[model samples]
Target: MTTVADLAELVRAPAALSVPGDVVAGATAARALGPRTAALAGASVLLYWAGMAANDWADRRLDAVERPERPIPSGRVAPATAVGLAAGLTAAGLGLAAAAGGRRATAVALPLAAAIWGYDLTAKNTAAGPAVMAACRGLDVLLGATGGRVARAVPAALTVAAHTWTVTALSRREVTGADAALPLRTLAGTVLVAVAATASRQRDVTAALPVALAGWYVARYGGAQARVVAEPTAGRVRAAVGAGITGLPALQGALTARAGAGLLGLAVAAAAPLGRRLARKVSPT
Candidate 1:
């Protein structure tokens, strides 16, 4: 029989912890935070969870061969049930977006959901995989900026997308390990992302929190990439991927702080270490 633990693993419940801050950073950057921010955050988490479920469902056959301990392959959850959950969550996420921010939010949510499904079903093994996954994350950030201030949120969205691309690229090698050069390149990209994130905001007393948080984000994520660069082993790659996923909240928090939501940004950043702690109990990847 399937227990709640099985479902939690299926959806990567701990990883979902990294998702809400995407919306918070976007909404704060767009000056769009309102009653809808909470709703959009919830919608983002639902969509993220949906993507995780869909990913397992689409990879069920492959998992049978390589990851037999997974929910579907292990017989702890039916394939059909996993797909059904993905579909249901997608619909619910779209509905929440629509209800919270009307047509604008729905517009972004539709494409976001489509990207999630596309990545799972057709793009997972393609060269386009990392880009597609990054787009999904970028759209999730934009979902919170649909309140007529989307243009203002572009920088935050792009920062999040760039960070996601590096993470996804590393994730591709989690099973087989990567060439040292690949992680070295990603490490360079991480530095550029950190520079861009910090430079985008004005330097002042108000910039202090964002700068510090962005530095923290860089240190944590960059440290993981450095490890992979040194070892280039599957275990190191997997650890880097997990760190990337869980460390995202810190990046988001930095962006949120850059947008003048320092306190709120700190609150969001707090989720990262918390997510890491939870990952020890339940795998985030």
Candidate 2:
């Protein structure tokens, strides 16, 4: 159970997804489009931590309803402390981005901060929430690209955003508990659409495998969920997917950034074998 007493822990949601590996992979691939790959990855991961904290703070009350165990409502964290931490992290993330890309990175950071804060405070309950989430995803990509000095982040940013909507939707299935089937199907559809969009870039059968494998993962575990209790099954499914997302990005960065599509396939194949231990991008919970 996510609790309020543990607000410090809330920041890790976005952070985990950010560094989990696949994002690093995507960022690595995009790094060639810029100048400082490592800096961009660092800033991007920080941005993710800040974004999650900001969102959680904004939605703390709502979360208490669905996830009373989350640090805030559970009394594990002080609201003021959480707010300060979020602000500090947000500033740090932007500062890093600015250092790497100068004014251009700062420009990108403003909208990202606004979008992340806005999503948490108000937009999440509306139809616009999902778009806001996608925007953050796109911004993360942009931040990573800016670090690498790439001005042409539009295509990859859009590609990542489209898939982000799926993740957001999949996440929606889990509130007080996790939902199994619909989210999986939605994830499959989203991945396919993203892969279809990928055709605009990769233009090879190899590009298709990631989506196909993702779809297979969904289908394989989605139905089996009926056999187990909702909480545990959903948690397991989320864990696998989460671990895959976390690690594959790093592997993808290595392969795709280096122009090795073969390596991207290897990342997908290796996703399940890796550990899902989530590390903090900021204050560890």
- C-alpha lDDT values of all predictions: 0.90, 0.56
RMSD for each model, in Å, please?
0.9, 5.7
Query: After best superposition, candidate 1 residue 162: deviation in angstroms?
Result: 0.6
Task: Using lDDT, give the best candidate's number.
Answer: 1
TM-scores for every candidate against the unseen true structure: 0.98, 0.70
lDDT score for candidate 1 against the true structure = 0.90
Q: What's the lDDT for residue 226 in model 1?
A: 97
Candidate 1's TM-score reads 0.98
Best by TM-score: 1
RMSD of 1: 0.9
Residue 278 displacement in candidate 1 (angstroms):
0.6
Q: Per-residue alpha-carbon lDDT of model 2 for 1-285, expressed as tens digits?
A: 435435437776533444423334444445553345566566666766776777667767886897677677776776776777788887887788778768866787778878888887788778787788889877766665554545455555665576566556555544333555555555465545434333434566666555554444444333333332344355554543353344334333323433334554455345433323443232222
Candidate 1 regions exceeding 4 Å error are none
